[model samples]
Structures are given as structure tokens and as C-alpha cells.
Target chain A: MTYINSFRTGLKEGLPICMGYFSVSFAFGIFAVESGLTVWQTVLISLFNLTSAGQLAGVPIIASGGSFVELALSQLVINSRYSLMSVALGQKLSREVTLPEKLFIAYGNTDEIFAVSVSNEGEIGTRYMAGLILLPVLGWTGGTLAGAVAGNILPAIVASALGIAIYGMFIAIVVPIAKKEKATALCVATAILFSLAFKYVPFLSFVPSGFTIIISAVIASVIFAIAAPIKTDEEEQSNG
Target chain B: MDNGKFFIYLLVMAGVTYLVRMIPLTLIKEKIKNRFVLSFLHYIPYTVLSAMTVPACFYATGSTLSAIVGFVIAIVASFFERTLIQVAALSCAGVLVTELIMNYV
Candidate 1:
């Protein structure tokens, strides 16, 4: 019953997320196919990677015959947030959770899952977190496979247009929180400044997008922290 | 696509990705004490999203002029705290219109 209820909750939260993933992953599938990867290889990548930016970045690297070290470093930089997310969720989880369970749940950590997990309050057990993780993974992987199979059925223009959905989803997540929190607003502004600098500044222009995101995130976080510290009560609650 | 090499790569990628996520939680069992670190993690999402959206406003199309015009329109719309969907849609529309005009003129 506990697992069932958790699954149901996950499904409810994951449905809209799945809808968004369908369009983005569909595009990824087409891109992978066009990039000389077979359908099975594409499916495997989606099943394991489950990160749009990481996979998109890595695909080009692989195609260019980049070394494994480069691929790993790029993924590390882009998906480093999962480490932070795992720590945040670790606080919410029951202390008695086995190491194996933690290992299993960690596999499914992505931006969307992390967002939902962090936003959930109170005592979050391993089972519930697992449900949250599994449902989204399933949805994303399923979408990728379906898209790979349905390749080229949709017009190129339509696919390109729909590619914006993932960006829209990110905006949806950020804008609401930024409106409510001044710190969020400041962080966003700092990130934009740094991002533009990385892109336009001649010396920094050569930095990869993944590394740029990591650098911008670190810089923004430092600025925000100095400007506004979290209140004691909020800290206590988060720690608890 | 050789099935054997493909599956090997998939397994290696999965293993590496999972390990990255596991290391912090397994090693840093205690609460995060460094104020700077906490602050950094807290603001990462904001920075990432802003970085993505800002350039997206410009450079999405081939022309820099259209990007600037589209970005100005988006900034004005966003000042009202418009919904994301509305802001994105409007910005995309702005870009399309600007490009179309630029082409004909």
C-alpha cells in the first residue's frame, strides 16, 4: 500500500513532466539517429544518461572521437547538481535507509526529479523517493525509445519548435521561485551576466557550455550567499 | 553499430553517472557547514536557468539585430512577472516577426 500510494503520487507529479520530456527527448532521438548512432545505441544512451544537456553535449564529443576522459569530465561538470540534490534529499530521507537503496535511488536523480524531491516536505522515506525516481526515469526512457522509433515522422520545423519546451519548463520552475525570493532574482541576474561574459568575452569564449554552467552557478551562489544568508529558523528546518 | 561495444559503453556510462551522484551523499554524511558551499548550491539552478534564457533571447536566429529586438521585448514583458509560457511565447513571436520584417525590408 505504501509503495502503491507513492507510485500514485509520483505519477501525478510526473505526468506533466513526462509530457514535456516527450517533445525534448523526441528531438534528442532524431538528433542521435542523424548523428550516426543506431536506434539501440540511442535508446541505451537515454536509458543511462537521462540528461538532455549532458547527452546533447556528449553526443558531439563522441562523434568527434573525443577521449573517454573528456566525455566523463564534460558530464561531470554539467550534471554536478545531482550531487547537491542527493545531499538535499538525504536530509529528508529516513536515517535507516540501507546503502543499497541509496545507491539505487541515486541512479534516477535528474533535474526534474531533484526539483520534485526537494520541494516535498516532511519525512521522506526511501520507498517514496524511489517511486519518485522510477516513475520519471520510466517516462523519460519510454519517451526516448518511442521518439527514436518515430523518427522523421514529424516535420523538422515542428521538431525544432518543440525543442523549446525543455527551456520553457526550466523557465516555469525558475520564474515562480524568483518572483517569491529576492535571493533567487539576484542569483539569476548574476548568472546572466556571467553567461554573457563567457559567451562574448574573447578569452572565455572558448569555454564549453557545460563548464560555463558550472562556473556561472558557483559564482552566482557565492554572490547570493554573501548578500543574503538564510535565517536560523529556515536553516534549522532544512537541517531537520 | 556493434552490439557488444555499444552495451559496454552504456554500462560504463551508467556506472560512472551513478557514482558521481553517490559520492557526496556517501562521503558528506554530516550537514553542510560551509556557508559558501550552501549558498553556492542554493543559487546554482538560478544561475543555470538565467544563463540559458539570456543567450536564448539572442543568437537563436542568425541575425544579431533580431536577437536584440526580441530580447528587449522579452525584458519588457518579463517586468510584469508574466507567466513563463506567456513570456517564452511572446519572445519567440517577437523574434519571428522581427526576422520576417528584416527579410522583406
Candidate 2:
């Protein structure tokens, strides 16, 4: 596809993500504020971070009066998945994708953007990713701004219900991919079981939420790689 | 949280997040030649998203019952290849209605 066409398609394909983010980040706004962050601080967090889980995870630590060490470590563990996503996206990126572009685009490389970019039919370029990331960034940050301003105004029932929307987006990413590949199905199951084990096991219970995510993801991916290495040629067809 | 400490918190969170995304994209210049390593990278997307989800989704909302109800709706809707918005809207509605009913109970 031409750059402009790919760029437009990227934006069009991203509409659902934008809408979903608005609702989800709206909840984040409320959470941040209810947790005692001023509206500007909440919006500032969204503006710079653009993360759902990391922000959700961190704001509470601050509200509960946790230390900087706890917050930083939590961030490193919860968001370490982005490093894996970055490597995966780096593979699909056009050679013309430059240092400056990579630097800017890297900030927008959340789960949804990575999913949308890799699944595209043509060479993934900067313009396309920029288009893809733009609206969601707006939706994510804008939603937070709205929520920060009027978060407490919403009825408790409504505000809490909106909380589930982001998790819904997470499910949307996994299901379609898993349906197409048994290896992926196995990987997801392993992740779920591992996450549950960490959550429920008494001794392992102290493993914080961030570390639990890192460990589950790394183990599942590593095991899948060793057990079922796709031939390089077969990779193209299987991935699509 | 004071403004200064809040900024420090935001700085760490934003900085580490950016570093994670930047390091692999900027540092990894060539195709990973190792097959095992290549496979690992290939599977990371699916695994990481899945791992992050699970237990988290089931606890996304206040009411565990309503959250499970929403979680199940999401999985089923997405399984049928429903669009993301459709799935999210459906699940969110599911949570809202479930919570509404439970509130009355």
C-alpha cells in the first residue's frame, strides 16, 4: 500500500481502539483522582505515560503513600513487556524508519498499536504507525482529562462498570489470535495458569502484580519457543 | 502526594516505559540469527498480552461476579470475530447491567 493509503487505513483501523481507550482511560482518570491525584497530575500522567496497567498500578501506590522504589520497580516489571513488543515491531518496520521516528513512535507502542501494525499487509512505515498511534493517544489522554474533571460526578455504578472495558480490549487481542493457532492457544493457557498460580499460591502470593506479569509472560513465551519453533518460511502464512 | 514527589513518580513511570520500548527498537538492528531466540521473540506478543490479562480481567471491576460476567462476554464475542468496539461495548454493558441488578439485590 502507498504511504498515504496505509496511513489512512491505519487511522481508520484504529477507530475502535480510540473509542475503547476513551472509556477505559476515563476509568483511569477517576481512579487517579479518587486516589487523591489532582486533575492536572492525572492528565499529566496520561499525557506522558499512555499506559493502562502501569498507570493504574502506580497511581494507587502513590495514593496509598508507597515509595519511589516501589513505583519504579512496579513500572519496570509491568511495562517490561513493551521491550518484547518493541523488538517484534522493529522486525516489521520499514528500513526507512529512522532514529527520530523510532524514538517518537516508540512512545506510542502500546499493545493495540503493536497488534494493528504487525497485522498490516504491506511494509509498516512511520506514517502508518503515526496515524495508528495518533488518535488512540488523543483518546487515551483526552479521556483521562475528561475523567479527571468529572470523574466523581459519574454515578458509582457507571464509573465502576466502565472499568471492565479495558480488560475487554485485552481479551479482544488474544482470542482471535489464539483461535488461529494451537501453539498460541497453549501459550495463552500457560500464561493464565501461571498468573493464577502466582495470584493464589500462598508462598508465591507475595510476588507483586508486576513481577507476576513478567514471570508469566517470559516463561510462557520461552516454553512455546522451545516446544514449537516455526520454520522461517512457514512463519509468514501462520502469522497472518 | 506533593507535586515534586508526584513528578518524580511520573518521571520514573514514563521513563522506564519509554526505555523499554526504545531499547529493543533502537538496539536490535539485525534479524536475530538464533532460531531459539527468534522463536521466543515471535511468541512474546501473544504470551505477554495473555499473561497480563487472565486474572486481571476477572478482577477488572468492583464486583467479581459482574467482572466475570463481562470477562466471559468479552471472550465469547471476540471468539466469534466480533469487532473490538462491539466486544468492549457488549462486555461493558454486561457489567453495568449485572452491577445494576446486584445493587438492587
Candidate 3:
């Protein structure tokens, strides 16, 4: 396919992902404001971060005057998966994507975009990656702007209801995968158990919230990786 | 938050996030062949999200009962393979309706 055709195909594939991001980021906007961030601040976070969970996790740290170390550490732990994704996607890039182009593409290497790009039939070019990243960036930032503005105007009850929106999105992402894969289901269950222990158990409760997330996720993932090593071929087949 | 401090925070976040992505994409030319590592990476997102969701999501709304209602609604919607927006909108609606009912009672 020509570059334009590749780009157009990417745009087509990205439409649904863009639409999905809008609603989820809208909730992020509302939640951020409720947590004390101004509308512009919330919007800026989405613009720069382009990550749902990382932004959600970072807002609390920012609002509560948590240290920079805490904020940076939280983002690193929460978003570390992007490193793995970028490495995977990088392997599929066409030679046309030089270092500068890779830098540009890296900005949009989000979970859904990476998934869409990697699932393509052959080598992915720079134009296709650009087209794929564009709409979702717009949707994510635009949704945050709209939701942040609406957040200031919306009633308390409505805002409160919207609080669960991100978590709802999180559940949506995990449930289907968990249902299809036994290891994933057990992993999720184990992580939840760890999370609850952090919240309720006496000594663990003293652990900072960011570390709680890091520790719980890491411990659960390590255990499951050992107990149920996935067949690499099976993993690719499922992803594709 | 002071303007300067907030910007610093944003910079740090965007910086670390960008580097994590950029370094690997720009430099890595080979696929990682470690079985344990691949499986671990596969499980990370699910585990991180699940860890963040529980207990925290249960208290998301004003009332735990309403939050539970929303959580269950989201689970059901997604179980049927609903799209992300549909699941999110439904969960929000679920919480709103439950809370409104709670007020009446």
C-alpha cells in the first residue's frame, strides 16, 4: 500500500479507539477536578501523558502534595508496560521509520494503538503509525477538556456517579481477557487479594498508596508468571 | 498547587513516560525471547489495573452500595463483550440510578 493508503487504513482502525478514549478520558477529567486539579491542569495531563491509569493514579499524588519522587515512581510503575509494548512494536517497523520518526511514533505508543499497529499484516510504516496515533490523541485530550469544563458545572450527584467511570473502563479492559485466559483470571484475582490486604492489613496499610499499587501488582505478576508460563506462540495467536 | 511546581510535576511525568517508550522503540532491534519475562509483561497491565480497581473502586461513589451496583453493571456489560464506552456509560448510569433510589428511600 502507498503511504497515504496505509495512513488512511490506520485512521479507519483508530476511529473506534478514539471514540472509546473519549468517554474514559471524560471521566478522568471529572475525577481530576473532583480531586482538586483545575480544568487546564487536567487537560494538560491528558495531553502530555495520554495514559488513563497513570493520570488517574498521578492526580491523587499531585492533589495531596505528595513528593515528586512519589509522583515519578507511581508513573514509572504504572506505565512500565509501555516499554515492553514499544519494544514489541519497534520490531515490526518498516525501515522507512528512522530515529526521528520513531521518536514521533513513541509519543503515541499507547496500549490500544500499539495493539492495533502490531496486529497489522506486515511491516508498519511511519505514516501509518502517525495516522493511528492522531485521532486517539485528539479524543483523549478533547474528552478531558470537555469533561473538565463539564465537571465544574455538573451537580454533585452526577459527578459522584462519574467517579467510577475509569474503574469501569479498567474492568472492561480486563474482563474479556480474563474470561478467555485462565492465567489472566488468576492473576487478576491474586492482585485484588493483594490490594485488599494493603488496604486492610495493619502494617501494610501504612504503606503509601503508590507503593501499595506497585507492590501488589508486582508480587501478583511474579507469582503468576512462575505458576503459569504462557506459551509464546499461544500469546501471539491470541494477540493477533 | 503553584504553577511552577505543577509544571515540574507534569514535566517529570511526561519525561519518564516518554523515555520508557522512546528508549526501547528507538534502540531495540530484537525481540525479547525470555519466556518468564514475556509472560510477566503479559500479566502486568491486568495486574496493575486490577490492583488499582478493587477496594478503591468499591468506594468510588458516595455510597459503597451504589459503587457495587455500578461495578456489577460494568462487569456484566463487559462479560457480553460490550464496547468500552458502552460499559463506562452503563456503569455511570447504574451508579446514578442507584444513588437516586437511595435518596428516595
Candidate 4:
């Protein structure tokens, strides 16, 4: 793809991800501020971190004066899946994308960004990646700033309503795939079962939410991966 | 924690997260060959999102009934393949409307 064409395609594809991030990060801003983070601190978290779940998990740790080791471990555990995604995405980059650009692109490789980038046909270029990352970053930081400032001013009804927006987006992403694939449906169902066990089971309920997510995801994926592994070379075969 | 300490924490958090994303993309030029691992990675996003959504989404709206209403609305919208923003907005609207009705009652 030429630079302008690649960048424009990226901006077009990134629009939805940008909008999705706005609502989710907006909720994060309010939640973080409510959990005792300053507005600036909350906004800065969104600006630099960019991972919603990680930032959401990190705020409480920071607020409570948790140890650095505790913070780092939590972040690693919560964000480890990104390593897999980055590896998957790396193979898709066009050769014109340099080492430094890859490093910068890696910074914005959130789940949605990775999904959008990897689903595109052929090699992904530097400008395309840059364009794709731009709006979501802006939306994330801007939404956090807006939500932190509006936390007090927004009525209880509106504030509470926004809480479900992120979950709605999550459902939007997963449900469509689950609908199309039986294996995905089974994986999601199993994960939900594990998630509920962690929430309600005695003793198990004490596990931190971040760890709960990782454990559930790992177990569910393992079961399905063993029972119904996808072709490893599936990506190389353009189905068209 | 003080500002300096907080900044340090944020830096560590960002650094760890960034490295998790950066190192693999920068270093791993070859496509993963392991079938199990590829399948695991392929399934991870859905599983993680599912695990996160459930139980937590039930408590999201602060009222279980409204949360359920929103959840159902989101699921239906998504089942119909609505855009991400459309599903999110519909669900939020559903929750807000439900809350308003509950309050009036």
C-alpha cells in the first residue's frame, strides 16, 4: 500500500476502535478518579498505558501504595497475552516498516488494534500502523480526561449507565465470532464458567480479578486448543 | 504514595506492559509453528473478554436488574452484528432507561 492509501485505510479502519476506546476509557477515568487517583494521574495512565484492563487493575495497586514488585507482576500477568498477539502481528508487517517504527507500533498493539491490523490482507506498513494507532490514542486520553473531569458533574444515572459500555464492546467483539465458530462458543462458555467459579466459590473467590481472568482464559483456551486446534498455517492461505 | 513514588509505579507498570508487547513484535520475525500455541493464542482474546465480561458486567450498572437488561440488550445487538459503538450505545441506553423506570416505580 502507498503511504497515503495505507494511512487512509488505517484511519478508516481505526475509527470504530477509536470510538470504542472512548467509552471504555471514559469509564476508566471515572472509576480511577473515584478510586482516589487524581484526574491528571488518571489521564496520564490512559495516555501512557493504553491497556484498559491493565490500567484498571493498576490504579488500585498504586492507590494503596502497593509494592513495585506487586505492581509489575500484576501488569505482566494481566498483559501477558499481548506478547502472543505481538508475535502474531509481527509476521504481518511490511518490510518497509523499520525497527524503530516497529517498537513504536508495539506501544499501541492493544487487542482491538491487533485484531484490526491482523485481519487486513497482506503486509502492513509503517504509515498504516501509525494512522491506526493515532485516533485510538487520542480518543483514549481525551475520554479519560473528559470522564475524570465530568465524574462529579455527570448525574448518577448517566455515570452508572456508562459503566456497561466497555462490557458491551467486549460482547460486540466476542459474540460475533462465537456465533460463527462452535469452538469459539465452547471456549467462551467454559471461560464464563470458570469466571463464575472464581467469583462465587469459597476460597477461590479470594483470587484477584486480574489473576482470575488469566487463569480462566488459559484453562478455557487450553481445553479448546487441545480439543479443537485451528490450522497453524491458516493465515498464510488467503481464503479469497 | 507521593507524586514521585506514584510516577515510579506508573513507569514500572507501563514498562512491563510495553515490554510484553514490544519484545515479541521486535524480535519474533518468524511465524509461530506450534499448533497448540497458535490455537491457544487464537482463542485467548475471546476467552479473556468472555471471562472479563460475565460476572463483572452483571455488577457494572450498580443495579443487577439494569445490568442484566443492558447485558441482554448488548448480546442481542451483537448477535445481530451491530457495530461496536452501536452495541455499546444501545446497551448504555437500555441501562439508563431501565434505571429511570426503576426509580419512578
- Using alpha carbons, what is the TM-score of model 4? 0.91
TM-score of candidate 1 against the unseen true structure: 0.82
User: How does candidate 3 score on lDDT?
Assistant: 0.83
Cα shift from native, residue A72, model 1 (Å): 2.0
Superposed model 1: Cα runs more than 4 Å off: A1-5, A234-240, B33-36, B56-105
Worst 10 residues of 3 chain B by lDDT: B29-38
Interface RMSD (C-alpha) of each candidate? 3.6, 1.4, 2.7, 1.7
Q: Flag the better candidate by TM-score, 2 or 3.
A: 2
Candidate 4 regions with alpha-carbon error over 4 angstroms: A1-5, A232-240
Estimate TM-scores for all models. Answer: 0.82, 0.94, 0.82, 0.91
- RMSD, each candidate, Å? 4.4, 2.5, 4.1, 2.7
Residue A138 local lDDT, model 2: 92
Please report how far candidate 2 places residue B11 from its true position, in Å: 2.2
Compose the digit string of candidate 2's lDDT tens values, residues B1-105.
Answer: 689888888888889888989999998878666778878877787777777777887777878999999999999999999987888999999999999999899
lDDT tens digits by residue: candidate 4, B1-105: 467887898899999999999999999876668898888878887888889898999998859999999999999999999988899999999999999999999
What DockQ do the predictions score, one after another? 0.37, 0.77, 0.64, 0.76
Residue range B1-105, candidate 1, lDDT tens digits: 566655655665666677778876666566566676666666665676677666654544447776666566556555666654455456556656666777699
Better model by DockQ: candidate 1 vs candidate 4: 4
Per-residue alpha-carbon lDDT of candidate 1 for residues A1-240, written as tens digits (9 for 90 to 100): 011226567667666666667666877887887777788788889888888777877777665556677777777877776776677666555666678877776777777666666566555566666667665676677767777788779655445444554565566666666778887887788888898899889999999877777788677777787888655436786898
CA shift at B104, candidate 4, in angstroms? 1.3
Per-residue lDDT tens digits for candidate 4, residues A94-167, read 76678999999999999888877876756788888888999999989989999999878888888899899889
TM-score of 3: 0.82
